[model samples]
Target: MPSSLARCVLSCALSAAALAIPVMSAQSAAAEVVPMPPHEKTFASPDGPTFVVGSEGESINKVPPLNASGTVREVFISGSSYTRSDAPSGGTLAVGYHVGCAVELQGGNVGVGPNAYLNPGLLDQEDIGPVVSINVGPGSVSDVPLLTKEVVSGVPARIMMRDIHLVVNGCIGPAVVRQYTLMQLHTDSLDDIGVVYGDPLWI
Candidate 1:
C-alpha cells in the first residue's frame, strides 16, 4: 500500500480502539457515593441549662430488589450531644435513624413530656444498641437507636455507627429514612428535651 494509505489505516484503527474503551464522567463517579449533609439543633431554656444535639452520616443502597418488594441498605451515622446543666439527676442522649416506607417523615411530631414516646423510660433494652435491624411496611415507621449513653455536665458525648445493615420489607413503594439525635436533661426544676433531625434519604 501507498505511504499515505497506510497512515490513514493506522489512524482509523486507533480511533476504533479509543471508542471501544469505557470512560466515566465526574457526575457518574460522584453518584456512586452519596453523602448526607450534617444537621444540628440547639435548645435554650430560661431557668435551666441549654442543650444541643447534632448528627452527620451517609448511606449506601444495595441493588434494588428485582421485584421492588423491599430494599437493603448500609448506613453510617455519627452523633454528638452535650448539655451545660449540672443537674444532680444527670442526663442522657440517644442517636438513631427513623425509617419509613411509602410514608412521609418530614414535619412529623415528636412528643415531649412524661407521656411522650421518646421518654427515657419508654425505650426498651432491645431498642438501644450499636447495631440494629429494622423492617417496616407501608404507612409505618421504625426508630432504630444506634447509641444511647449518659451525658456528663459540660462534656460532649459522641456516638457512631459504621456500615450497619438496614433491611426493609413489604413495601409497596420506596423507602425513605433520616437520622435523629434526642437528648433529655433532668434539671433541678424541670425536664429539658433537645432533638436534631437530619435530611431524608430515599433508597
Candidate 2:
C-alpha cells in the first residue's frame, strides 16, 4: 500500500474508533479479570495450514461484546479497522468521513452499537471499503452464529457483508450480542470484511 493510502486507512480507523468510543459507556463494567485461555492458532485457507502461539499473558475476556452481531474475538489477533481507498488522496477524503467506528470492548462485557453516532463528519469521497483480515494469529472466532447475512455484489463492499444477526437460532446469549447493527458506513471495493475460524478446539 502507498504511504498516503496507508495514512488514510490509519486516519479512518481513528475516526471509527472515535465514533464507537461512546458505546463503551453502554457496556456494563465487571470486576475480576478472566484468565486468558490457552490457545493454539492454525490456518485452513487454501494457502496452506500454518500455526503459531506461545504461552503468555494475553488475558482472556471472561465476556465480550458483539460487532454487528458477530464475535468481537474476530480481532483477537489483527485488532480493528476502518474505511480506505485505492487513491492516495481518495483515502484521505474517504477516511475523514469514517470517524468513530473502531473496535472497542471494555473488558469482556462491553461493545459499540450499530448506527452508533459517528461524531458527525463529511468528506469528498463516499466510496471506500474497510480493511479486513487476520494478518496475525492466536485468536479464536466467536461462537456467535451468523443469523442472516448478504453481500452487496459488484461493489467493493461485496467483500463487506452486512446485517448478520446472531439470535435467529435463539441460542445466542447477551454474552454474544446484546443489541447490534452492521451497516456499510463506507467502502472502496476492496478490503471486504469476511469471516473465518481459527481452530477446532476454539469451536
What RMSD does model 1 have? 10.5
lDDT tens digits, residues 1-203, model 2? 56998999999999999977766744434212333333332222232222221122222223233434433332222111122222211111111010011222211211124332122122111223222211112232232211122223222211122211111111122222211112222234432222222221120
RMSD of each: 10.5, 21.9
Score every model by TM-score.
0.60, 0.19
Q: For this target, which candidate reaches the highest lDDT against the unseen true structure?
A: 1
lDDT against the true structure, each candidate: 0.57, 0.25
Tell me the tens digit of each residue's lDDT in model 1 across 62-136: 443334343443333333433344444568887667778764332222223323434322343334332334544
lDDT of 2 at 192: 26
- What's model 1's lDDT at 156? 69
| Candidate 2, superposed: residue stretches over 4 Å from native | 1-30, 44-57, 60-203
